[model samples]
Target chain A: MQISQQQRQLIQLFRHPDEVEFSNIDWEALILTGRQNGFLARLYYQLERHQRLEDLPQYAFKHLHSAKVFADAQRQQAIFEANEINNSLSAIEISPVFLKGTAYTLLDHPVAYGRIFNDIDVLVPKPLIEKTEKQMLLYTWFPEPIDEYDQHYYRQWVHEIPPLKHASRRTIADVHHNILPPISGRAPNIDLFTQYKIKTEYQCYVLSPAALTLHSLVHLFFEEDFSKGFRDLSDLHILFSTHYQDEKYWQQLRFLAYETGFTLELFLACHYCEAILQTAIPFTFKHELVAFSPSPMQLKCLNWIFLRVLQPSHPNYESTSYRLARLLAMLRGHIKKMPIRILLYHTGHKLIKAFERGILGRYSDTSSNLQPQPPDKNN
Target chain B: MQLHQLKFDDYIHKMTNDGLCLDLGVGVFRFKSHITSVQQNVYEMYADYNITEDKPADFHACVKLAKGPRHYINPQVHFESDVVTPFLPLPKSQAFPLLEWGMNWCLSAYDFNHFILHAGVIANQQNEAFVFPAPPGSGKSTLTAFLAYSGWRLLSDELAIVTPDSLTISPFVRPVCLKNNSIKLVKDWFPQVKFTDTATDTTKGDVAHFKPPANSVKQINTPAQIKAIIFPRYMPNVPVTVFKLDIIEASEAIASNSFNHNVLGEEGFKTLVKLVENVPCVELQYSDVNEVATFLQNEEW
Candidate 1:
């Protein structure tokens, strides 16, 4: 909800790269923090846009420039993967709805221009999810060899199936039936998103602007991982700046969120996008978003946690209270996504694993050669 | 000021407290380590290196001695490159060795500005760089340490920070890491060279790092133009053999040893072509350092 002084330096430069006052900045911390928050290359783009790259110290300039080169390569690879997946799934009469990073790349969204993607995320209709996975496996994409209990957990409750990784290429693709897990009881009807699909230039399907923005918002607010919080919020700012129109546009986005049972997500996204990123949301929408807000006490607590978590730091460097915030936020995420009984079961199972790894000196699977190989046991 | 100017106690206090900020030729690093082995290694190996006091560093790395219930039973030291541990904590005995490995990891992973080649580099008195590009067990580091003590200046033991288009490499004159039998053989051969205690049963067998010659560290800021690429392999009891490689053959061999040329793609290919065209490549196989050193001396650049 608020930027730290460190975040302010980064956000300020993002807003006005050409005008950045060099004297006040700690170039080392600034560079590392920018990189940690997934903004280094994006910041390169900003600085490049303003023709201010020449002003940076050579070391800073090289790192930022190098990040752009890397991000560009990753984006190209993602595009190639999306088209390959599109070609594969087309045989089964399913055009997967690419989401998040893949969708952003397919659409050539500037916000994602300099970002990295861990995997390609796509959604298919619930009925086709099985067929889609079978097709993927037939085409040399196998479910990642996760543990048996984890496999059961994903199958029983998670939004997506186990990730399907390409055999030779080792690239990952997340095939999802719903954006939100069905156990959330608030997973939107898939058809609502499907209606707005626009075929990309490469023939991969992506949601139209409004629906896409709504989904991004939902993903941002619901996910516990705040490591990419700044990147996601920055993306929303870019999307809003491009998509913002008169009252009708805001109204349509709100209606979609309401119809899809994500009014709360929409509210949080709008409030934070404006508050943190300084996005120019219409005053009318701001007033209307208030209706979706939690109580003042809840808001205060949310701000306390989100502010610290949003200013991302690597886990090792995190202060004890910040780690506590992350833990609370993670538990809060579990509660938000699962029913009470399922949440308890899932939490207990994970707690035991954590205990074994931490207190019981299992340490890691370092000495073990028991990793699941081909002909995965999960299937 | 050079690091050797500080008293040993003062250096350890500074390294553990305010951190030892080293301008390591290729990149500046702030090393904050409480581990005695790590501190001692820095003191011994980095005596002639410049210290950038109170300056912002390029990387903030640490070798922290692990603390927990497991600590007393099985002590380990984490090799954290900046905010994250690049590798799992190693046995506390391996602290100094881990730091050496961590420094290389930091350069390869974070210093995207240059072509960080997986090669050992040594420059003759004229500052003409000779690159020995080889994978592990190829005796690259061993050969590099052997040459550095035998009058050549060591540029780098693990990574060669090649500046693209400049056709030059900045000296990365840290300690040369020796593995397994080579550690003992090297220590015996070069009796005067200071070496860290052998870190037993490391991933690279028994590993130890010996200091670069002081002359190399003294010229840490000097950049050397590469003159020859010698792909070396240690063949026990083999006769000294030197085979000249044509440009294409040399290009392919050096390319395999380059870490980030793949990252650079076509541009890197062009640079590799230009380098091979300018610098002759050769393959050397020998067990005797004396024979290999004499061969290198007699060869035309």
Candidate 2:
């Protein structure tokens, strides 16, 4: 992607906060863009590392410092929630593998520094999925009260169960049996992932280095939404950079991607990271990964679409092409997830619900409730 | 420059495009909207605040009227920032309320430099401010409107941003929100005070905002030292009474009323402790605003 000068500056500051000077930067746009990409706190933490506290601009320093404080509190809360889940599921004889954000925090990876996460995703053995759900129910975790259609979709087609929320704490957990949906025809063997799980200091399991990178790749590239594209791509950059120093890491990543039927995901991750983030990769590996790329015409279209979609969705950077590209990406995601018939049924149902809510004015009354409450059916 | 200084057409054009950046004492906000009523409200309510032409803003917000599916059936207004929409849409007529609510949301949600309290603040001529840390319907707004129009300077009627290290309260001189019966009461008590058209059936029940005194807006950037913290409640026909609260009680009350105390963590705790330790805390219960106002004006702290 040919990022703008502002984006380039942001990337440089993100990578080497200690080296970049911030005297002449546009603080407003930088803060807005960082916030849009979920990197405001991360940016603040980086700047804090390199600059003296007294030298910073008052407005910039105060906001960033405040963000850092908030990030710390959220991180602590996430850890506490993870520990609670761990203690709850201890009786099931199945250790939950913390995935993505929670795993990053639990393992204390650099990526977790100043990261903000909403939900905890955990994976379990396919055979133990049923037992784990029952155990969670005993511990007061229930499947979020989604409607019948969504419940059916999750149970019959998706890789994970309907997201489970604790009754009191309201922390969400998604229990997954595979990385990709079974209906998507790309679901990898559960054993391939289970074999690489490693114990962490906190008594939970996280994916091994190679598996972690591959999973992040699958999560980022295979997902339909680009709302968190920049943040997720940053995660890939951090993981690759942290692990790439080991000579064996590259080979292991390639071998694992091939074994898990996710070589395309890994290739795209490497391709974009190298192009956008300037992540270093061995020349031979870059050339070798090209063999796993899609056909030339499809590759060209995808590259054009993804480059637009991956950029921060700030208005200052957005264009009509980007909006169209996002739509194309969403369509492509649905196509990749299910066969045409099921896709049509699902899309039709959602469209009708939207039409009813919008056109028919089914739920037009506005309530005066002031306190924040969990979203209910009426909302 | 101020918002009213611009021609109505120019103000609408700027607001619809980039946004009209207004300095709200503690912070700057860029507000964008295409709705004519919203524009008029801003012009009337923010006529005294500073308008930034090319300067950088601390926050950007917009009240976008709902389009497509829901527009024709029942129009709605959405409160959005550059990053996310914090709340669901409301009726289109409530755009002004949505703008105020959105601005408050931005300050409370994003501005972390200050320990924010859901309180009303009014200052004396010496710049010693009294903070009323209370919840909704606690007569805080009534007392604030009464004091502001009577003699005291209205710093802010909704938000009080106290610096964590210094415990100095920064001024956010905006309109005082008066709800339901208080709207009539304030109008009756202070006939000279200007108010925007009352919004009926609002979430806060027939809400109207009374303009701050001109002197208060002129000294918007001035900081004030905390003189006392009072938790006020209104009970009809109850004898007007004031009870002193200890440091622990005051700290707990202030913390509970704070918006970002938990997010501030240890710094939040320390700031609250310092505020409680140095200031006298009291709870005043009364029915009449004048009775509470007289007591507050005469009380020696």
Candidate 3:
């Protein structure tokens, strides 16, 4: 994948935050591009860790200060919401297992330092899914409105229920019964995943170290869109690099991957992390994972597509190949997610909606008629 | 060099490719617009501002016409930053106003180092500033226009960016946004003042922008010290009166009108408190701009 010079510098700083020699770099372009790709806060966190604030140019320092302030507020809000969720589910006696960003945040993992997310994702036992939704509703979380076709699709094929948003705060929660959809024919056994859950300091449960990495792999590799590819892949790098220091961790991860029908995902994750981020993997583990690698032709094609799609989705760095590769990857993702009949129906419905909306028309003119008003005096 | 020095063709070419960078007091804005109307608006309104040739800009803004089916039918214009579209498209006729709104959004949204308030600010020759914090329909813009022409320097008509460490308010000398009946009122009051073409049926009713005094644009980099905070309310057919507000009440009111006070957390709160404690606070009620202007002119700290 082709990356701009500015992106390369950002990645270099991410990997090595202690080196603060930025005498020749263009801080203006770097800051604007970082903000564009939603990496400014993360970059600020890294630089702050090394106490390199004084080294920044005046303009960069001011903007970075602002980004840091926003990131701190977001972190505090996420923590407050986590506590609220815990209180809401206390009656059911079923501790919701936090997934992805929320889990990392609750566990105080380094990967969560500057990360910002829109929704909190949680997994529950399949039998308790209904009870969980009821509990959420009792706590003022209402299900968002969905059209009939999409509602049926989620109920029949998706792993999660329709997303629920808090009535007052508008925070979103994705309630799931399993990590992957059953229609994919590769859903991990719920009981097996539950066996590996560990309690956090906050008294909520999170996936064990090996389960966490494997689930992240499955989530990223099986997705139809790459809008979040760069951020998710960075999470993979941070988690793997942080955990691989313990020999026991690596062995347990490999064992869990094979037992859970995710060896292929594990292989691709390690391959890309090393190939793209240049994350250091032990020679022995790299050799061992090669046994589960795909065929040579499949490996070549996957590498080409993942490399392009995984780069930052900023238009300044994107190209014709990037768009084509993303489209092809989307098709492959749909194939992996559903059977032929379901895929045809879903794609057909979406195509009709697109036609009716006239392609580029995401919003109706009637909706745009709402005028901007000044903020209320009492607000 | 100033933007006015560029030939129209050269300006369009630069804007389409590299961008035409303008130093806008607090930060430099690099703008690229394919629409001719937007270009003309910038040329007229920003003529007094400095132009940066190859320097880096704090923000990169563009106003691109919508493509595909909507482009040919009811053509729309979109305001874009590098990666995000902060707003929906407006009709092509509103491109210039869209540019103004977009530039204001970029400053108020991204410039987090300052404690930004939805207020009008102006200064005396001594650099003593009065901050007017009000919501819409408060006649803040009309009051500001009146003062700017009556021996007061127009600091800004909308955004007031106050530095946190030092409570000095930075000037953002852009055009004053006049809404509805205020549009015609301002035009009648200042017959010599230049305004962009009025945009009707906008979300803010009928909208137009009053150009800032060229002297204000020339001295944009000047920062002003706060001497007073005034909350203005306009009520028709009422005698003009000014009431002093307690320090606590004034601080709370100013903080509520700030754009990013919550994001700045404790520092934001402390800055506002310190400002209110040091400056006199007052609330003024009036129906006539002339009366409000005279009251401000006769007041002493």
Candidate 3 DockQ, CA atoms: 0.41
lDDT of 3 by residue, A1-379 (tens): 5677776777777777666468767787778666755677777777877888778878888777777777666666667777788778877787888888788888888878878677888888888888999999999989877677778988889899988889998788898999888898988887777778888888888888777888988888998888778777888888898887778778878888888888999999998888778888777889999999999999999988999887656667678888888998898888888987889988999788767667556465233213233223211
* lDDT of candidate 1 at residue A298, scale 0 to 100: 90
lDDT of each: 0.80, 0.81, 0.81
Error of 2 at B12 (Å): 2.8
Across all models, the iRMS values in order are: 9.7, 6.2, 5.2
Model 2's chain A TM-score stands at: 0.90
Which prediction has the highest DockQ against the true structure?
3
lDDT of 3 at A112: 80
TM-score, cand. 1 vs. native: 0.91
The candidate scoring highest on TM-score is 3
What does candidate 1's lDDT look like per residue over A1-379, in tens digits?
3334667788889887767887778777778888788788889888887888888877788778777767777787789899999998998788899988888899987767888778999899888888999999998999866788878888888789988889987889999988898889978898988888888888899987778899888887777777787888888888887767756557778888888988888887877777777888877788888898988999888877766666646543567777777777777777888999998888798788766666534346433223322110000
Q: What TM-score would you report for chain A in candidate 3?
A: 0.92
